[model samples]
Target: MKVSVWDTYVSREDGKQMHFDILVPSDLKDENTIFNFGKSYLKSKPFATKGLTSKECRFCHVEQASESIEEAIRSKGYYIIEMENCN
Candidate 1:
């Protein structure tokens, strides 16, 4: 049950800076977890997402995400640790 919190940043539709921490198990490497994270994150941050489509969510766009970020996420395990909005 080990966990790690990775700090990251994202820009809101209005250009506001949002900081966040993604918590994941130490051995995560599954795409389903990423999709689930996107689903859950959107529900928790509707204002930030505003009018974006599912494909527009950061978690859903892992392929285009920074390599380091994706690597870190995959290296961990397939379950979502926690998505903390640090706005």
Candidate 2:
């Protein structure tokens, strides 16, 4: 199994920006696939929750700004798969 990564930035509620990556399989290359993968990846994270906010925790920014970042990743086509598969 191979993994694809998309690098991007997210803005906190305080307007602080942070960088993170959206990871998926290289086989899932389409925008819809990447978008759906982003949603699933976010929902599966421990930090994800209802009414998530970026008030004090920067990590919460990820949950709040996931859609936009995912769209940006899809639009930019900035994704890569590592040679080695962790799977």
TM-score of 1: 0.44
Can you write out model 2's per-residue Cα lDDT over 1-87, one digit (the tens) per residue?
344555534343444444545554455556555554444543544443332233311211112334544565566543322222111
- Please give, for residues 1-87, the per-residue lDDT of candidate 1 as tens digits: 444444445556776655544555545545456445545555676566433333333432122334455565566433333333423
Pairs that collide in candidate 1 are: 27-76, 27-77, 28-76, 28-77, 29-77
CA displacement after TM-score superposition, residue 74 of candidate 1 (Å): 18
lDDT, model 2, position 75: 65
Provide the RMSD of all predictions against the true structure, rounded to 1 decimal: 8.9, 13.0
Q: Give TM-scores for every candidate, taking all chains together and pairing residue i with residue i.
A: 0.44, 0.39
Task: Pick the TM-score winner.
Answer: 1
Q: How many steric clashes does model 1 contain?
A: 5
Regions more than 4 Å wrong, model 2: 39-87
Which regions of candidate 1 are displaced past 4 Å? 50-87
